[model samples]
Target: MSSHVAPDDQATSGLDRRGELREFLRSRRARLRPEDVGLPSYGRRRVPGLRREELAQLAGVSYAYYARLEQGYGETMSAEVLDAVARALRLSEEEREHLVRLAQPERQGTPQAAPPPQRLRPSVQHLLDGLGVPAYVVSRRLDILGWNRLAATVFGDWAQLTPEERNTARLIFLSPEARDRFADPERTALTAAGALRMNAGKSPEDSYLSSLIEELSQKSEEFRRLWARHEVSCGTVGDIVRMRHPLVGEFDLVHESMALRGGAPMRLVTYHAEPGSRSEEALRMLASWELEPRR
Candidate 1:
């Protein structure tokens, strides 16, 4: 069957939602084994993971129906049906939401103008400035919309970068300094790519977002590999993030992200170190450098 773009997406941004849906489902299915889902293994399989028919049986749907959906032709699929399929695939919360978005673009209501230029609210800016720790605001697309002085000091002066250069995915994948700054570049890059994938599902018709993904795919082999995994995540639990800063040497900080209310999809991300710790001391010293007179 020939694949087609969703009507809303085509009219707004011409993104290939059908292709995305197919790939996402395939990737999710690929990660599971027959035994993983309480299915008895039979003869040797030609492809990896559960066959389309097996998955259909698990979801209590017809084989042809599931195959059509996999091929990107089930726009009318009910939420109940999708939910059952999600359960059959053992998808995560974020992944299930992503599936619905991809499978039913029309339900997303009126599309925005390919995402207008996101501006940071003054109150949010004030909130970032008031925080002693490194803090910044990021759009759903992972664009660094605004950051505080301490954040600039810790994460490198994003002010020096072009708007496009300030994106988290771009910084992690394409920037050399990012590889050096991150203690685990591979994990960081994967996280960034996964977040990007999540946003892609949310706003598939955003041209700028599509361009960013294409750019990274072309320039970064690592990004290409991670993007193919089709993982979806909005946030991870608080964990110590080690940074190898050129000026501060090295330090660890715990990261937290909160969604900003009454605005476009944006997150307030902050990094803080434990009190009375060596990392805290390093952060204090780093903050003072920003206030020191230029020599």
Candidate 2:
């Protein structure tokens, strides 16, 4: 028997989500100080961050062309240019992959019927349970799929919120409480924006993502300014996060992510510390607190 495929399959399967790439590049460029990259500060500039002309010069592109690219022009951007831009922005390897994915999303063999629900597999869930560490799975869209009890405790009230409200990016920019929760609110806010920039490139047509950007832009002037800068960062693995929990007080945690197979909507995230460290002691206290029954 012969099988027939839908005519629109190719378009759907091979869709390119370059809008995110533009956003990511812009965001990264916005955060850098002129002196950070060995350029002398000429004089008092109106913008606190790097100017577009300075970024273009560093990335070896014309200011007008760079503006067009960040504005989602989707012109033919060469790999060489992409490389230069990544270098100028000091993008990590993972961040570079995120850039490539946004610039050229891989055409899947089959089109997905719907966006994958954020979920963790049984095996991964079991692994999380066994590790007894603060762990969770986050989707490419920054959805918190599944998290351990310790994760719930460590993240405080934020973790207890409904999945719709638990989004890190939304909470960081849209919720004032989140800003208070983090010790370094400004860094947290910028990092969340950068991650969102990376995601924008991969799923440009996603309404939820667009809605998030709109909400943040309206609610937070700082978010609006950072969003316009269009920086991107792949926060997938090995990032240090310092948080001030209402219960645990304050602790430093290492955030690590491992990819799952079979297009799983989840990536494994675990928080741990060096052996016999103060963080380990904090983890023990956290675990004890989690075991106690809630009032």
The total number of steric clashes, by the backbone 3 Å criterion, in model 2 comes to 9
Shift in Å, residue 166, candidate 2: 2.4
Give each model's whole-structure lDDT: 0.79, 0.65
Q: Candidate 2, residues 144-190: lDDT per residue as tens digits?
A: 77767787677654445776877777777777777666777887788
Q: How accurate is candidate 1 locally (lDDT)?
A: 0.79
Off by over 4 Å in 1: 1-14, 247-249, 291-295
Instruction: List where candidate 2 sits over 4 angstroms from the true fold.
Output: 1-77, 84-91, 94-119, 157-160, 176-179, 291-295
Q: Could you say which candidate leads in lDDT?
A: 1
Which one wins on TM-score? 1
Quote each prediction's TM-score. Answer: 0.88, 0.70
RMSD of 1: 4.6
Quality of model 2 by C-alpha lDDT: 0.65
